[model samples]
Target: MKQLSLNDIQAAAARLRGKAVVTPLLSNIELNRRAEAEIYIKPENLQHIGAFKFRGAYNRLSQFSEQQRQAGAVAFSSGNHAQGVALAAKMLGMPATIVMPKDAPAVKVAGTKSLGAEIRFYDRWQESREEIAQDISEQTGKVVVPAYDDLDIMAGQGTCGLECVEQLQEMGMTAEVFLCPVGGGGLIAGLSTAVKALVPSVKVLGVEPDLFDDHLHSKKAGSRQKIEGTPESICDALLAPMPGKLTWSVNSRTVDEFLSVTDAEVEEAVRFAFRYLKLVVEPGGAVALAALLSG
Candidate 1:
């Protein structure tokens, strides 16, 4: 896998310009007061696909060659990435096939299909989506647009962190710390790289659900760790068994620390965002705020 560099991030920002939404950097007085520190929320919940996944997905698909674009695209995602790829491919006039777990949220599945992507459901307990995706690729001759492991996707995801730093500069404020939820580790890896590159003094922290803290364990062990059993957490988006090899490589070097939060804390944070911020944040999306609150 190729390393996502600063130049790649810059190119991603340019490629995604006018294609992806530049989500607002919001500061809640209540959260700042409660955390006893300056807090800024990059409201990715308001993004086109309702999450930051769109940044990476769009960036990756937008760079596809004419032959690849004509051949279509395939990806395996539980939720957000499915919607992101579906929407991006639709916008670019390319066909997309998404393989999702049968137990994935109905809202996400419906949203992805609404964008005209072909949906295939697999049993997470019995089948490997990676193998299924590869089979689909072989059968359909579609290019596999991986969710996190690809260099283009990582560069695209880094655009979020780039926007965060730019927003801080515009506000005449700088963050001492940056926190993001970790799953397959793409978002955190991309964000940490961008944050540390732009604001070298800022601390980049990855927040993981206690039941699915593979990134935390992997970092400590100096290798990727896979969870054998089912994840018991309500943060469905953070339940990846282990970080992607490419994402882990970037994160192992860029991220400053890791923090784990309980399922109940994630639930409360999601509820709080919905009630107070009027944002329908998924449990995984609210993990960063959960960490700040718990601390």
Candidate 2:
């Protein structure tokens, strides 16, 4: 698998200019006081489709050639990436079809449908989303837009890190440590690549649901780790069974450490964000903050 570079993220930043929202780095006074460190939160739950998935979606979909764009695109995601691809395809005037698990959140399903994408549901345990997407691509001639495995997708996710660094720099602050939720490791891989490149001394950490700690295990083993058993978590978006091959290649080199948080911790973080920060964070989206608070 090919590894992503800082330049890849830089180019992605350029592509996302004026397209993706530069989400704010939020700070809570009470939390800061308690933590004894300035905790700057990149509230990506405020991002388009209510997560950072839009960055990678737009970056990949926008790069499709006229023919491919016209032919359309197919993707699979539990939720956030489905909405991301759907919305991006809609904005770019391309048809989109998403393969989603039947048990995905209703709000997320409605969100994706609202963006005018065709939805296909499957039993996540009994079926392979990638195969479904590929089947659809073959039948319709639409390009398969991978949720996190593609280079462009990884690079696009990296833009979040770039924006974080820029936002911090604007505040005359430098990150001592940076944390982000990890699923297939795409976001962390991209974000770590950019954060490490721009702020070399800053530690980049990935947070995962304790039940689905493939990235964490992989980091410990110094290699890819295929998780066993049926993993369950409220953080649906962070339940990817293992890191993407492409993403792991980058993450293994760039990220400093992996942290795993329990569902209860994530719930607490979500409640805290709502009560104090006035921010609504999904279970997966709040894992990094959960780690920061509990770790």
TM-score of 1: 0.98
Q: Which ten residues in a row have the lowest lDDT in candidate 1?
A: 228-237
Off by over 4 Å in 2: none
Predicted candidate 1 versus true structure: per-residue lDDT over 1-295, tens digit per residue: 5777888898999999998899988878788788898788998988898888998999988988999899889999999999999999999999999999999999999999999999999998899999999999999889898888888898888998999999899989877899999999888888888888888899999999998899889889998999888767888888898889999989999988899999889888988788777888989899999998888
> Per-residue lDDT of 1-295 in model 2, one digit per residue for the tens?
4568889889988988888888988888988986888898888888889989999999999899999998999999989999999999999999999999999999999999999999999998899998999999999999999989899999999999998898888889888998889999889888998999988999988999999999889988998997798978999998889898888888888888999999999999999999999998889999988998896
Estimate the TM-score for candidate 2. 0.98
User: Which pairs clash in the backbone of model 1?
Assistant: none
- Steric clash count of candidate 1: 0
Candidate 1: residue 24 Cα off by (Å)? 1.0
